[model samples]
Target: MKKLTLFASAFLLSLGSYAQQALWGGTNLVSPQINEDKTVTFRIHAPKASKVEIEGDFLPPTKVDTPFGPQDIPSRAPFKEGKNGVWEYTSSVLPSELYSYSLYVNDLKMPDPNNVYQNRDIATMTNIFLIGGGQADNYMVQEVPHGTVAKVWYSSPGLGMEARRMTVYTPAGYESSKKKYPVLYLLHGAGGDENAWTELGRAAQILDNLIAQGKAEPMIVVMPNGNGAQEAAPGEAPNSMVKPSFMNPKTMDGAIEKAFPDVMKYIEKNYRVYTDKNHRAIAGLSMGGFHSLYISAYYPNKFGYVGLFSAATSKQVNKGVTSDVYENLEDKLAVQFKNAPKLYWIGIGKTDFLYKDNMDFRKILDNNGYKYTYMETDGGHIWKNWRIYLTEFVPLLFK
Candidate 1:
């Protein structure tokens, strides 16, 4: 037994010796290393690659003409070769915001292999990092109390899916206490699922920081999958592991709007929440913005606070009887405003593709003398703008 134990110990030592060779610290190379001067240095070890470029939103924007309008897109910067085929580039002083980027080697686009921090937008994945000391400071996990986010499954009878998934976030101290909290039904844009807001938009982190600071009221946030045919996000449902797309059937055709009650019912029944309109808020970005608009209007008096961020006011496809949800918008808005919601907030980027559509929708409200707050920012339909909108919008809820 002593000999066997000694042999086992020797074998473990041998394995440990081999493990150190394939570890992370050996490279001493960091793709994104934040500097004291606020500039970020990115390094990639690709001695064989001839040309390399860093593509991220932090760089200066270049104007690109599209069908919607000319928009400022993220431009790339060349990486100079360093010692030992290590390509490196130091960025200019960057503002405090969550940034995402990809690397191009010889014109082929790919995520930074060195940076394990990444996010998925539709079928594409890009590395993400946060620069602290500004709005993005809220995006980072601080020493304050944190919230609990869970992937829950509930039955949605209307969609004919017996069990569907949703992302629910409960604020800190929720479990220890029995108090009921206001609910914010935060929806995601197209190509996003229940995971979008929490992952890409930093919803959980923002809420935790805001609630801790007492700047925002503690509230329960529910993120539901807007796609009707999809039981959940890609790979989340049984036998449905496929690449995510921006558009899906039955999402905007009123089926989701009709079926939205299932999500609320589940939340109200299973979680400790206030079931009144005054305690309810619904908000989304882009496609999610459209959903929030129609759902709140269609079920007028359901939510007291409504927010649309870079919302796409049009592009509703007709799918049989489900198309009625898209119709009679003026009438629906009339009914919705009759009760005079506590807040009707709208925000969009100046260069957003749906800026005009949002404006057209606003004009309808303007013509009808409806009361709503509007905020416009600089940028297109991207996550940077959406994160800013969320941080701005949530503080004003349930005040």
Candidate 2:
């Protein structure tokens, strides 16, 4: 055992030395150097490549036509030609927000070799940076008390899964303290899993900062996979390791709403959480929004607070399928309202594809004399708006 351990240690040391050498090789090269001003300078060393360009949310968005409507996607801009084999581009002054950028060399996508800070959204990986000083600061990690995030597995018999995974975020002092905390069930959009809010939405950072500054109540945030068919995120499961597509037919088909009780049950059983309508909140984005809507309406007296962030207000039409979860919508809303949830909050971007759908849903609420809070911001269906909504919505919970 000693001999084997020593051999493994030597191999790891050699590997570490190699990594150090490779990292220090580009010590003088800085790809993304945040300037004194907010403008950012990006660099890439592609001497042989005929062309180099960058695509990111930092640039003017490109509007593209989709089935729902024209949606704004990231725009691409060319980088200046090579200077001493270093290709570069300096962006215009940007606002405070999290930004992601992808590099292209000779029309082929490539990761920025110089920047190690990157995040994978589905199959594509892009380098990311935060231009802080405003709302973006809420998404950043600061010298505040951090929270505990656990990937817990629980039985979901309602969904026909014996055990499934979820991401739970407990406040900074949760483990040491005995007092019970309220819970916010934070669902993700289509193509997202339990990890989405923590990674892309910055749920943990936002929660930590809010609680530290006493801007919001300290509550447990539960992020579950809304897709009823999947046991967990793509690679985390025992199934295929291939990248999951951006859309899944199984999501938002009334099944998640039917099975939501399993999730709530697991949380209430394992964690130290208050068990009542007033102490429970549920919110989601896109398909998650749809799930939130139907789930809250289906379980009328369950949640005190309901937030719909750019949610799909309409249920997906499945032919030859009848479910109690999807039927009697206005009746359910009537009951949901009669019970009088403390907040029925809705937020969406002006240019989002689902903007009209949301407006139409609001019309239903208006005609029925149901009162709710609404917020409209400038942007399309994107993470920027969802993150903003989360930061805004969380503070209003349990207050």
Candidate 3:
């Protein structure tokens, strides 16, 4: 009798696992189906629970990353209790390009067994929702004029890493056309990898739109792994935490100067790229931004245009008055401005925590008689503002 009972328990467990797998088979529970009313419905049938609601980045113009973009729908509607004794709720959200959401019961974030688009990149599973089903043209890998995206690997002697790989997006007509194109070295932020710009920033689409509109010159964009550690960028093992390393010039110089030059030499020799300072540009976000500032200044002759977007420039913090990121390096950086670089552009959101730093940096430049452009918009440190900044900054490159 005990043997029979054990067999029954094992069979039941296997059946439950199969059922769970089937539930998340198709669309994934995280991607809610958009009803004709333009309303989104998120359902979790935990009927035992007294309360439940949906939360996510449904609202627009709101901070998504920092404040955490999620909203709780009031549970006024009666939840239909499923056979498994679970409750569910559906809510509507205004349309947008993309969003992230999840079910929260009381305060715990619950996973949707029915939704398949759930991303478990973070420790807690989060639901990913896309409302406006546009081409995401900004993020698409295109075949126009024929640009090639190659995943290539290299060894970095500076950081003592072997087999470091990155994505290089060559513009259309790169293969057939003998014309050498300008290169834009773009960097991603913290919690992002080499593919961040291509995936989330819609980099190709932005470049396509700009080129088509005659707003910007067509160029190759090299997205490198900003983290010194090799495993970090690919989400592989041996991942190292990314911190603000711009304050320490020794480390920044070692990584950017020695390690990055290897990437440049490899590109120039293999690809049909322009090998001059006038055709080279570098820009980045957050930690990448600090790298941009210091890297450009340190090696002024290497790049012509520099862009900083929503960056953390200093280790020192200011309540609302000033930033020390550029304070110590002011005199040395001024020499870079005096010597090379056609365009030195800095972009930041007014409400961003780094706003004061940006403003203070601008003042330092102004005080030093440096000619640069400063862009101020309404936003915090988020991708929305960075997207806008990229659109604006790319056009000014190689001009």
**Backbone N/Cα/C clashes per model:** 0, 0, 19
lDDT of each residue in 1-399, candidate 2, tens digit only: 999999999997888887956745664678788897999999988889888999999899999998877989898898887667788899999999999989999999887888888876766788899998898999999999999999999998888899789999999999999999999999998888899999999999999999999999999999999878888888998874867877765675667888899999999999999999999999999988988999999998899999999998876434465778888899999989997899999999999989988999999999998889999999988889999999999999998
Runs of candidate 3 exceeding 4 Å displacement: 1-31, 34-49, 60-96, 110-125, 130-147, 212-214, 232-234, 237-254, 315-328
lDDT for model 3 comes to 0.67
How far is each candidate from the true structure, as Cα RMSD in Å?
Answer: 2.8, 3.5, 6.8
User: Which scores higher on TM-score, 1 or 3?
Assistant: 1
Candidate 2 minimal-lDDT segment of 10 residues: 314-323
How much does candidate 3 score in TM-score? 0.73
lDDT of 1 by residue, 194-256 (tens): 999999999999999999999999999999999998889999889888878878877777789
Local distance difference test values of all predictions, in order: 0.90, 0.90, 0.67
